[model samples]
Target: MKWMEFSVHTAQEAVEPISNILHESGASGVVIEDSNDLVREWNGAEDEIFELSQEDYPDDGVLVKAYFPLNSFLKETVEEVKQSINDLLQHNIDVGRNEVTLTEVHEEDWAQAWKKYYKPVKVSNFITIAPSWENYQAAADDELVIELDPGMAFGTGTHPSTVLCLQLLEKLIKGGEYVIDVGTGSGILAIAAAKLGAKKVEALDVDETAVESARSNSSYNHTEAAVTVRQNNLLENTKMKADVIAANILADIILRMVDEAYERLNTNGCFITSGIIASKKDEVKKALLQSGFAIVEEQMIDDWVALVAQKK
Candidate 1:
């Protein structure tokens, strides 16, 4: 099979929104190549090391890449993608150069190449995300491991936004509480919640591919019995109440769903949100407050910020 590689040159601030745009355009998986990774410090478990090369990254800005199966409508899809990326500027996002290029390649060329870069990443004190291909052992008796393929999904559960969300989950989950992971992506958070002793987890995503990937990851992690993957759009038409709701998605989307999340959360239940760039943090915080949530905690890693809010 052949795939079209869509690559974008953009600023760090634009990475999240641009990546979201690519995912919404039917990309199987997204790859981010930020130049900062070359010099960034590795704070993983003591034994973990990332061997990165200067040649593999952009010199000035971040490169966001995604793959789409070659199809007749690809040309149109590419055009739409470009337009959507440009539209990010309307949200006050810095898109940098916003240059886009497409290359055709065989599936075999990239299907396994990216795996070498993904290893067991200790995203939080209690949780580590390991690729299904790697044999990762828990370093401590209390450490929880989430095995994921990510396949063509959005993330491997190691992104900063995801890490922040997972950390908040670890701090908030007290076992046997119902949790809902909106825009679950690869189902990392839902699985984490289950592993952390959530009695039940509802992993929701609007994309069928994401829904399937989440289900597969949950089953692989042996959390299927407690984690239910569903194709739903940000709590729309859902009636189940949750003790906690986690959403690691674009801040704009998070704003759109704030009311829904607030409504679905039980008394004193927390709403954990990430995928917010620093510039948009205040906007999200205000929305959460207006929705009757009292901001309880906030954490920032690099340019991403995650917030934990409790229902008043």
Candidate 2:
């Protein structure tokens, strides 16, 4: 079988969303090449060493690649992917060059193409995300591990947005709290919440593939007993009140759902949001405040920002 290798040149802030668009378009997996990663410093003897070549990365911004079967619907799928990516501009997301290119390759080539780009990453002080194929061991007694097979889904739990969410979840989740993870791609946050001692977790995503992926991941993490994965729009018709709610989606979607999140959280509950570009931080802050949330903590990493607000 043949496969289409699609590549996009986009800004760092646009990486997560664009990868998500690719996944929703039926890409089997994704590979990200960022110039910054080439120069990043690593600590600890267990950290994996990468041999990166300059030729593979852009001098600025990021390159995201995905693979899809070369089926009859390939052209239509590509057009839809491009249209969805272009739609990001309407929400004020910086898509950078937004240059997309495609190449054809054999199925064997696509199978191992993305593996080199993925490795176990320590996302937070206590959490590490490792691909299923990697051999990783916890360096600390307190560390927790999340085993995931990304398989075209969005959450690797290592992106700045996701790491910020995990850090806050570590701090905010008191034992026995109920948590809701909106747009739970890969079910990372929901599983983390469950492992962190949340009594119950409700994970929701609009994409059926994401929903299925989340369920599988929850089970893999042994969190299925505590986490429920469902296909539902963001917080729509969600009747269960939660002690903490996490949404690592775009700023616009987060803005639109602030009121619903505020309503669904219990008194003094925490609402953690990420996948917001730095420039839109204030805009999201304003929306949260207007919806009766008190901004408690703000975290910024590179060009992304994550805000933690409380229902007062």
Candidate 3:
């Protein structure tokens, strides 16, 4: 089928409005580039390698992407989508601005094309992400494995947040301990916890796509533990707790839920956190201390830190 390419140079400020318009208009997807031209996905794939990886865009500081397969309305009203985006950008009196471009694709198969870019990755010494399309060899006597494909959610263990969480989980989680992974992206952490010998594990993400990804990954591992996957927004039910909890979410969320996490842990239970920039480490530390969590261990890599703290 033919697809139309919608390109826009949108600042972070105008990205949301343009995204809302596209969503309301039933557009297939919209991709946004930040002020630095970094990649951000509003309604489509989350692969941002082009921004961070040099191989994809060797021409430094140039960020450009094409979104295709416009919905019926968007295809018919292509000019309308362009106008909405252009209007939103024009409304913002920012000095440096982005422009929008439109083009048509005679024929394309996005679903089949994206697979060529997806590859197997290893997050830890003990865990490897084998996409369903590739062959993964396990070391002799290896006890655990995790299998996944980049279907529709993040967390193939390639993201910094997921890797840091797994690193912290390996240390904080002992054999046969109960673990909770809030906002479990691809169930990567939950699968790792189960492999690390957690007697019971629970993984929940507010995003339904994430929940599905986690479930599929868990099943691929053939995990025996009760790795319950649910669609919950944090631990609203105060009656629950865990021996270990790993939340690799935004810094704002980590600070906001510090108290609830403290209240939701057994004495000596460790809480591991990641997805924090180095600049926000102090904020998290202060929140943890104020919430009665004693620092246990901390590690940082590539401008990201993961902290393991025990209940005081």
TM agreement with the true structure for every prediction:
0.94, 0.93, 0.72
Give me candidate 3's TM-score against the actual structure. Answer: 0.72
Worst window of 10 by summed lDDT in candidate 2: 41-50
lDDT of 2 at 172: 98
lDDT scores for all predictions?
0.88, 0.87, 0.65
Better of 1 and 3 by lDDT: 1
Candidate 3 lDDT score at position 128: 58
lDDT for model 3, please: 0.65
Clashing pairs in 1: 28-152
Instruction: Return the lDDT, model 3, position 31.
Output: 35
**Ten consecutive residues with minimal summed lDDT in candidate 1?**
41-50
Model 3 clash number: 0
1-312: candidate 1 lDDT, tens digit per residue: 999999999998888888778888888778888887777665565676557788888998899999999999999999999999888888799999988889998898888866766888777777888889898888889989999898855667767788899999999999899999999888999999999999999999988988989898899999999999999988997888999999998888999999989899999999999999999999999999999999999999878899999998
Residue-by-residue lDDT tens digits, candidate 3, 194-265 = 988898888878767668778887887776356989888876653556899888876667887888888888
